[model samples]
Target: MKERVRAVLVTADDTMLVIRRTKPCIPEYWVLPGGGVEPGDESREAALHREIHEEIAGKAHIIRLLHTMESEDERQLFYLARIATWSFEDRTGPEFSAEGRGEYMLEEIPLTVEALDGINLKPDEIAHVLRGTMEAGALGDGAAA
Candidate 1:
């Protein structure tokens, strides 16, 4: 069973840091700033810290386990976080660069329900869930709470 973790860093203005997957070469998709959970990882949170750093050069505070999804033999954990600063010039590491899953395009966009309304979001599933999840008040902040 393979497991992965991603940190969905939302900004004060409600935008998300996303990465366009440029490898595996199958109908390219987008994902949050994160990577796999390695044995060297001290913990899940530690992995999140490392992944975000490598993927988006992002530093954030993990708020909670926002969502969990499983497919066949793979499991993905998405965390809700707040990012203070980030830079694409610093994004680097194995499995996500010249040493791994090709190159990735780091993009940030408004994290809104409209993202699901044919907004050309990547990783179709992500855009699908974001709208309902945020609107359901599951994020615990209630959009304005």
Candidate 2:
């Protein structure tokens, strides 16, 4: 099975950082900053840290594991985290240089439900989870899950 890690990266201004993907013949969508867990990674959290750095050129303090999605051949872990800084222009993820992988634009959107609804956030499940959590006042509390 394959494992992936992603972060619900929240900023000091109560906005979430996501990547906007644009490709030919496909509708635009947003995604959390993350990637597949590598075999060399010491742990899932370590992979998350590395991915956050590679994808956004940022360091994140992970608060806690927020959600998990599993299928027959893949599993994804989502963590809630706080990021104080990032340099999108400095991102070094290999995917950016790969041909035909599409364009990736780093974007910060409000953490509000309205913002989440306005874009097609992939994996549908994560967006739904966030919406429910936000509605119940269980998220965006700052530095803690």
Candidate 3:
């Protein structure tokens, strides 16, 4: 099975950092920052750190695992994290330059159900979970702990 990691990045302003993806033939959607775990990665957390750096040129302090999704062929782990800074223009992820991969824009959105309703965020399951948690004041501390 393949493994992937994603970050639920929260900023000091009480917003979530996400990637807005726009492809030619598909509807635009938002997603968290992350990618597959490479063989060279020392651990899942290490892989998340590397992905965050590559995708947004950001440094993050991962708080804890928030949610996990599993299927026959893959397991996706979502982590709650806080980011101090990032430069979207300096992103070095190869996917950004790949042909037909579409536009990846960094966006900071309020962590609210209304915000979630306005955009189509991938991995619907995770989005739903996050929204519910936010409404319940569970994300006040930035993680699921």
Candidate 4:
């Protein structure tokens, strides 16, 4: 089965960093920063680090594993993390150069139910889990740190 790692990146100001995707003939949607766990990766955490660097040109301090989702063909691990900096212009992910690929723009949004409601975040299951965690006081105001 394939494995993927995603980062729920939270800034010091309590905003979450997400990638806004815009494709031709489709409504725009947002997703967390991450990608498949490649063979070169030493571990899941290592894969997360690599993906973050490639997609956003940033380094993060991973706090902990926040959630997991599994299916017959794939498993996804989501980690809660804190990032202090990033340069979207410096991104080097291969997807950025793929032909016919959509735009992947970096956006910072408040980690709130209202924000979640206003955006179409992929893997809605994870979004629901994140919202629940936030409402339960497990992931805001440095609570996860």
Candidate 5:
């Protein structure tokens, strides 16, 4: 199975970082900032931190391992991260893709169940994650407000 990593990067203002993927294969989709692990990576968490810095140009503290998703063809690891600072102009990492997917537009949106529900975010892994986070009592009480 293929393996990858991602981050749910929440900022101090209660917004989460998302990227508009420019890849032709995806066409106008949004996702959290991250990528597949590299052979040079020391650890998964270390790769996550490095990826966050590359994707959004920010520093982040990993809150926890939110979920691990397994499928017939792939496995994905998602982590909860509190972001510190960033800049879209300085953002990197889209270049790492094998297809050389380019020019991702970074965005910040409120971290709410509604925000999550409003979009058709994909990979099924994310939807599974929402259910897990909710079941584990992982979400904040005031998030929907």
Candidate 6:
């Protein structure tokens, strides 16, 4: 089985950081920043931090484990986190140089339900969870702090 970690990264101004992926012959979609958990990673949170740095050249303070999804061969852990800054231009992820991996554009969108609805965020279950949480105000103003 494979394990992955991702961050629902919130910025100071209440926006969420996502990566817009564009592939040949496929519609563009957005995804949270993250990747597979490597054996060298000390923990899941550490893997998230490492992945954020690799994918966006950013550092994040993870607040909590927001959600988890599992399939027969893979499990993905999503963390709620706060990020103060990132430099997409400085990203060093190997995927960027890989062939046929598609385009990865860093974008920040409003952390509102309407904003979530407008994008084809991958892993529909996580999108639905975000909508429900945002509606209940469970994330709150300080969620990004």
Cα deviation at 128, candidate 5, in Å, is 4.3
Residue 62 in candidate 5, Cα distance off native in Å: 0.3
lDDT of 1 at 114: 59
Instruction: Name the runs in model 2 displaced over 4 angstroms.
Output: 142-145
What lDDT, from 0 to 1, does candidate 4 have? Answer: 0.92
Please give, for residues 1-145, the per-residue lDDT of candidate 5 as tens digits: 6668898877778777887666656656677777778889998888888888887678888877777888899778988878778876676665745465555677776666667666656665686576466556565432322
Q: What is the per-residue lDDT of model 3 for residues 1-145, given as tens digits with 9 covering 90 to 100?
A: 9999999998877789999999998889999999999999999999999999999999999998999999999999999998889999999999998998999999999978898788899989998999888888888565532
| lDDT tens readout by residue for model 6, 1-145 | 8999999999988889999999999999999999999999999899999999999999998898989999999999999999999999999999999999989999999989999999999899999888899998876554746
Error of 3 at 36 (Å): 0.4
Best by lDDT: 2
Query: Cα miss at 6, model 2 (Å)?
Result: 0.2
Question: Candidate 5 — worst ten consecutive residues by lDDT sum?
Answer: 136-145
- Alpha-carbon local distance difference test for all models: 0.73, 0.93, 0.91, 0.92, 0.73, 0.92
Instruction: Report the lDDT of model 6 for residue 71.
Output: 100
Per-model TM values vs. the true structure? 0.80, 0.97, 0.96, 0.96, 0.80, 0.97
Give residue 32's error in model 3 in angstroms: 0.3
Candidate 4 lDDT over 32-141, as tens digits, reads 99999998899999999999999999999998898999999999999999999999999999999999998999999998888877889889989899889878767885
Instruction: Write down the RMSD of all candidates, one decimal each.
Output: 3.0, 1.1, 1.5, 1.2, 3.8, 1.0
